[model samples]
Target: MKHIFAALCLLAAPAAAQNAPHVVTDIAPIHALVTQLMEGVGEPSQIIPTGSSPHSYAMRPSEARALRDADLVVWVGPSLTHWLEEPLDTLSGDAARLTLMDDDRAVKLPMREATELGEEHDHGHDGHDHEGEVDPHGWLAPSNAVLWASVISKTLADVDPANAEIYEVNSKRFAEEVGALEQEITAKLAPYHDASFIVLHDAFHYFEATFGVEADAFIVAGDGSTPGPAQIKALRDHLAEDPATCAFTAPQENDSLLRTVIEGQGTRIAVLDPMGDGTTPYATLIRQFADDMVACFSQE
Candidate 1:
C-alpha cells in the first residue's frame, strides 16, 4: 500500500506542474506589462535581468532553460534583443512566441536622422551609423504600450482560457491607467516641448514624439556603443553652436564624458533610465520617466 501511494504521488507531479501556465518575457518593462496582465492568474518570469542592456546581452544557461520550459514567450524581437533569436528558434521552437515589434498593432517609428553637425562632419569615419532603421523603444510610448497590453491579454487568454476573464479585466484597467498617465504626462511636459536636450542614447525618440518633447541629438549610438571621435567632435560642435540647457545620461553610463563635452556650457547633466529599474506595477515606471524628464528639462 505504501509503494502504491508513492507511485500515485509521483504520477501526479507533472500534472500539478502543468496546471499553471509559465510565461516568460525578455525585458523589465515587458515583464511588467505581462505581470499586470497575469495578475490573479500566474506570475511571469523576466529573462533579461536588471541593469543589463538588451542590445548586447548574452543569455545564461538558466534563462535558456526558462525559455525552453515556458508555455508562452514575449519579447521586443531581434531589433532590441538580437541574442534571443537563435535560442528561441532552436530551444523553444514549439512554444508560442509574441514578437511585439512585428505586431501590426504596435506603432512603429522610424529612426530619426542624425543631427547634421556641419559640412566638415563626416559620418563615414564614424562606425556608429543607423541612418534608416525603426526604433524598438516602443514601450516608452504609452499608446504603443496600451496596444501591447491588449495583445498580451488576448495572448494570455488564448493560452490560459480559464483565466481569460481576469486577464481581460486587468488589461482594461491597464489601458485606463495608461490613458490617464498620457494626459498627466502631456500636461507636465508641455512646458518643456520646445526645450532642447541631449540624451545618452536615441532610445527616447518614441517617448519624445509621443509627448511633444524634443531631443536635439543623442550622445551615443543606438547600440549603446561609444561614439567615434568624429561623432564626438560633431556633438561638441553642435552643443557649442546650439547650446542645449540639459544633457541626460543613462544610469549604466558614466557621465564624465558628457560633462567633459559640455563643460562650462551650463548644461545641467541628469540621469535617465530607459529600463524601468527598481520600479514595479509598470505604471510607476512610466510616471517616473516622465517626472525625470520634467525635472531635468524644466530646470533653469
Candidate 2:
C-alpha cells in the first residue's frame, strides 16, 4: 500500500509541472515578442495590464499572483520597466527569466538621454533625437526582434526542456517572418531618407535609425513629460526651418498638444503605434510602420 501511494504521487508530479503557466510583463511590445517565441509551447500572461505605461506602472494584486505562479517571466529590464523592477525581482524565483537588456547575448542599442519621466532615450550619429532612456525600444528593430526570438525560444526551452523542439520550430518561423519584414521596411522607407518629420515623443529613435529616417522636432521634451512654452517655442522654430508636413506620435500619446503646437505650422498629425498593434507579428508591424511613413510623407 505504501509503495502504491508513493508511485501515484510520482505520476502526478509530471502532470503538475507540465500544467505550469508563463507570465510576462504587461509591456505590449515585450508581450508581442514573447507571444511569438512561445506560440506553440505555451502562452504568457501579461503582468502589467494593457493601456498603462510601463515606465511608471505598478503591478496589480492579480499580476503578483500570476507572477508567483509563472514558470517563466520575460521583461526588458530595470532600466526600461523601472516601476516593475522590485516586484518582478520579488516574484521571480526559480522561474526561467530573461531581461533583454542585461542578457548580453542579444544585440542592443547604445545608451542615450534620460527622460524626466524616466523613459529611455537615444540619439543617432545623424543628429536626430531618438527614443527611450537607453533606446530600450530595441524591439522596434526587426534585427533585434530576431535576436529576441532566439533568446526567448532558448529560455522557454530551458524552463520546459521537454518542449524544446516546439520552441525551436516557433523561433525559426518567427525569424523568417522578421527577416522578411526587415527587407520590406528597407525597401519601403528607402525613399524617405531625406524627408524629415516632427514627433510628439522621441520614441522612434531605433525605428528612424534602422531605416535612416530623421525627426526634426519633438513636441514632448521626453517620454511622458509635456513641453513648456520655451520648448514649444523651440519646436516652432524648428517647424519654421524644416517645415515638416506631418507630426508623428505613438497611438497612446495625447495628440491635442501636438495639434496645438503644430497648428499654424501647417503640419498634420500622423499617429504611429510604438506598441506594434494588430499587425504586431514583428514583420507585419514593421510593414505597417513603413506604410504609415510613406503615407505621412506622400500626403499632399
Candidate 3:
C-alpha cells in the first residue's frame, strides 16, 4: 500500500502543476502589472530580483529554473534585459512570450542625444545610431502600462480560459486606475512644468514627456553606460549656464560623481527608482514616481 501511494503521488504532480498557469515577468514593475491582473486567478513569478538594474543584471541559477518552468514569460525586450534573450530563446522557446517593447500599442520613444537639453531639443537624426533604437522604459509611461495590462490580461486569458472574466475585470480596473493616476499626477506636477532637472540616467524621458516635466539632461545614457569625461564636462557646463533645480539619481548609481558634477549648484539631490522596488501594486509604483518627482522639484 505504501509503494502504491508513493507512485500515485508522483503521477499527481503534473496534474497539480496544471491547476494554475505559471507566468514569469522580467522586472518588478512588469511583475506588479502581471500580479495585479492575475490577482484572483494566479500569481506570476518575477525573474530579476529587487535592487538589481535590468540594464546590467546577470541571471542566476534559480532564475534559469524559473524560466524553464514558466508557462508564459513577459519582458521589456533586449534593450532592457539583453542578458535574458539567449537563455530565454533556448529554455522558454515553447512558452508564450510577450516582449512589451515590440508591441505596437506601446509608445516607443527615440534615443535623444545627450547634448540636446532644452524644450526644442532635436531628435537623433544619425541613421547609424537610430536603427532599432528605442527607449525600453515604457512602463514609466502610464499609457504604456495600461496597454501592457491589456496585453497581459489577454495572454493570461488565453492560457487560463477558466478565469477569463477575472482577467478582463482586472485589466479594465487597472486601466481606469492608471488613467485617474495620470490626471492626478499631471495636476500635481503642474507647478514644476518649468522646473529644470537632471536625471542620473535617461530612463525618465517617457515620464517627463507624458507629464510636461522639464528634464534638462541625464548623466548617463539609457543603457547605464558611464558618460565620457567630455560628456561630463558638457553636462557640467549646461548645469552651470542654466542651473537645474534638482538632480535626481537612481539608487544604483554613484552619488559622488553626481555631487562632483552638481557641486555648488544648489541642486537638490533625490533618488528615483525606475524599477519600483518595494512597491507591489503597479498603481502605487506610478504614484510613487510622481510623488517623488513632486517632492524633489517642489522644494524651496
Candidate 4:
C-alpha cells in the first residue's frame, strides 16, 4: 500500500507540472517581470507585440485565443492601455486577473497637465492639470517595480498554490535586483539632478521623481495623444526662452512633429525604451533607460 501511494505521488507531481497554468500579460515590461517569476516554471504570453505602442494596440487573433485559454491574466489597469479593459472582460473574463494599479500598495502619481498648446485648442490630453488622474506609466519606478514583483507573486500563488514557493522565491530575487539597480541608477542620475531636459511626453515623472532627475517641461501630454499646433508652438517658445540640453522620445512614438519642435534648437534627441525593449531583463531595461538619459544629458 505504501509503495502504491509513493508511485501515485510521483505521478501527481508530473501531472501538476504538465498542467501548469497558462499566463498572459498585457505589455512587454509586465511580461518581462512575469517571465522572471516563471523562470523555472513556464513562460507567459505577451499581448502587445514588440515596438508597438501599448497606449493603443489592436489585439491579434492568436493573442485573443491566448486570453481565452489563459488561467491567469496580468495587466496594468486600463490607464496605460484603455483599449484592453473590454477585451479582458470579454475574452479573459474567467481567468484570474491581477490589475496592478488596483492594488493599494501601487504608488500612483497625479496627472500631468498637457502642454500650453493643448490648452489653446478645445481638446487636449490631460488638459485639466488637476490631481485626480493617475499617470499610467507608474511601472517605470524602481519602488513600483518591486511592488509589482510582490503583487505578481501573490497573484500567481493564489492560482497555482503548488508552485507558490517558487513564485515567492523568484519575487524576492527580483526585488533584490531592483534594489541594486535603484542604487546604481541613483548614482548614475545624481550628476544630472540640476541639469535641465525635456521629454516628448510625461511618461518619466515616476522615474524622475524617484531619482531626483526631473525634466523641466513636457512637449506632449500626460495621456499619449499628439499635441496640437498651439502646444508645439508653445514648446518651441519654451525652448527659445530656456533651452534644455536634451529631449527624450519613447521607442516607436517619435514623429516629424517632435523633429519640428527640436529643429535648430541643437538639443540632442535620444530614445527612452519604456516598454523594456521587449526582450531584455526588466532590470537591464531600466538600466538602459538611465544610461540613455545620462548619455543624452552628457552631451555638449
Candidate 5:
C-alpha cells in the first residue's frame, strides 16, 4: 500500500506542477485552426476577438495581457497580419511564435491581375502596381492550411511536450478534413459553367483563383484603399452596362459606402468572409464560403 501510494503521488505531482500553457492568435481563422489542433487538449484564447479587422486592428490592454501571458503565439506572419508582428515579438518573448508564411513548407500561389482571369467586364484599371506581388490572403488556400496545421502540431508539441501525441493525432485528423473540404468545394463550384463575381475589396483573389471563380471589380483600388468618386462611378457605369449578378464584400465593410456607390446597380451585395469569423473547424468555414457563393449565383 505504501509503494502504490508513493507512485500515485509521483504521477499527481507532474499534473499539479504543470500549468495549462495559454495560446494566442491574431485572427479567427488561425484561432479556429489552432483550436482544432488543440481540440481535445484545450482551446486557445484569441488575441483579436471576433468581428475585428486583423489588418488594421489596434492592440488593446487585455489583448496585450493575453499575448504576454500566452505560452504559444501562432500568426500568419507580418505581411498578412501586419499589425500584430512587432507587438507580439516585443511582448511575448518566451512564447513560441509559429508563422504559416515562414513555415518553409507552405505552398505559395502566384499573384496576378484580378481582372485578367475574371469575365471581361472592364471597371477601369487604376494602374495600381501589382507588378511583382504575392497574395497576402494565403490562408484561403487549403494546401497552405494543411502546412499551417503541421506547423501548429509541431509548435504545440514544443509547448506541451507531454501532449505531443494528442497534437499529432489532431493534426492528421484536421488535415484529412481540409483535404475533403478542398475536394468538395472543387466539385460544388464546378457548375455555374461560366460565373464570376465582383468585390469591394481585392481580398478574395486567392479564394477566387483557388475555386476557379473570378472577381471582376473592386470598390477599393489597391492595398485596401478606397477608390474616388470618379473610379467608383466608372465601375458603376460599367456594371450598369454589363450588370454583375452579385457584388460580394467583406463582413467588416461599410454598408453605407457600398450602397452609396453601388446604388441603382442591379448587383446584389453578398457579405463574404475569408476569415472564419463566428465559425469553427476550417472545413466548415470553407463550406460556408462556397455555399454563400453558390447561393448568390443561384438567386438570379
Candidate 6:
C-alpha cells in the first residue's frame, strides 16, 4: 500500500505544477523582479513589449489575451501608466492585482521641479506645489526593489500555494543579490560626490537619491511647456556656471535643443533606458546606471 501511494504522489507533482497561476506584469523592470520569485514555479508574462514608453503603449492582441487570461496582474500603478488603469479594470477585472506603489513597505518620494543655476533643490517639494503627487520611478531605488521581491513572492505564494516554498526561497535570494549589488554600486559612485549632470526628464531622482547623486538642471518643466528663449538662455547660463559632465537623456528624445545648449560646453550625452528591451535582467539594468554615471566623470 505504501509503495502504491508513493507512485501516486510522484504522478501528482507535475499535475500540480501545471496548475500554477498565469501571472502577467507591466514594463520590463517589474517583470524582471517578479521573474526572480517565479523561478522553478512558473514564468510571468509581460504586457508591455519593452523599450516602449509605459505612458503610451498600444496593447497587442497577444498582450490583451494575456491580460484577459491572467490569474494575477502586477503593475507599478496608474502614476506611471495611467492609461493601463482603464484596461486593468475592464479587461483584467477578474485577475488579482498587485500595485507596488501602494505598498506601505516601499519608500515613496514626491516629484521635483527643475532647478535653476545657484538654486538649491528642496528635496521634498522643491518649491513645487506637488503635494500628493509621487514620482513613479520607484523601481530605480535598490531598497524598493528589495521590498518588491518579498511583496511579489507573498502574492505568488498566496495564488499558488503548492509553489509557496519555491517562491520564498527565490525571493530571499533576490533580496540578497540586490543588497550586494547596491553596496557595490554605492562604493563605485562614491567618488562622484561633486559631479553634476542634466536630465531630459525628471525620472532619475529616485536613483539619484539612492546613490547620493543629484541632477544639476532639467530642461523640460514637465508642464508641457517647450523650452522658450528665456528658458534656453537660463540653461545656457547655468551651463556656463555649472558645466555638467554629462546629460542623461531618455530614449526617443530629440536632443537637438539640448545639443545646442551644451554644444561648446563639453557635456557628453548618455541615454538612460528606464524600461529595457524586454530582455535586460534587473541586476544588469541597475549596474548599467552606475556604469553610465561613473563613465560621465571618468571619460572626462
**TM-score of model 6 (CA atoms):** 0.86
Off by over 4 Å in 3: 1-18, 118-132
Q: Go through the candidates in order and give each one's C-alpha lDDT.
A: 0.80, 0.69, 0.82, 0.82, 0.74, 0.79
For residues 237-264, write the lDDT of model 5, one tens digit per residue.
7666777778787777666666765688
Give per-residue CA lDDT, model 3, range 1-300, as digits (tens).
999999988886654234778888999889888888887666788888877888777788888888998889999999889988999999899899999999987899986566466432233222125345798888899999999999989988898888888899999999999999999999999888888888877888899999998578776677666666666776777678788888898776778878888998999999887777634687787788888888998777
Query: What TM value does model 3 have?
Result: 0.89
Q: Model 6 residue 22 lDDT? A: 95
- Model 2, range 193-294, lDDT digits (tens) per residue? 888677777667678878898676665543355555655655565566557777897777767878876777777778787775422566667677778878
Model 3: lowest-lDDT 10 consecutive positions: 119-128
Model 6: residue 245 alpha-carbon error in angstroms: 1.1
With a 3 Å backbone cut-off (N, CA, C), the pairs that clash in candidate 4 are 117-230, 117-231
Query: Candidate order by lDDT, highest to lowest?
Result: 4, 3, 1, 6, 5, 2
For candidate 4, write residues 165-245 as lDDT tens digits: 989999999999999999999999888898877788778889988999877777666677666676677767777777778
Q: What is the TM-score of each candidate against the true structure?
A: 0.89, 0.83, 0.89, 0.89, 0.85, 0.86
What candidate 5 gets wrong by more than 4 Å, as runs, is: 1-18, 110-130
Query: What pairs collide in candidate 3?
Result: none
The 10-residue segment with the lowest total lDDT in model 2: 116-125
Q: Give per-candidate clash totals.
A: 0, 7, 0, 2, 0, 0
**In candidate 4, how many Å is residue 80 off?**
1.1
lDDT of 1 by residue, 1-300 (tens): 999999998886654234658898999889988888887766788889988888888789998899889889999999888878999999888888999989887888876545442333346325645666678888888888889899989988888887788889999999999999899989998888788788767788888889898777776656556667777777778678778788888776777778877877788888877777523776788788888878887665
lDDT of 5: 0.74
**Which stretches in model 2 have alpha-carbon errors above 4 Å?**
1-21, 105-107, 110-133, 277-279
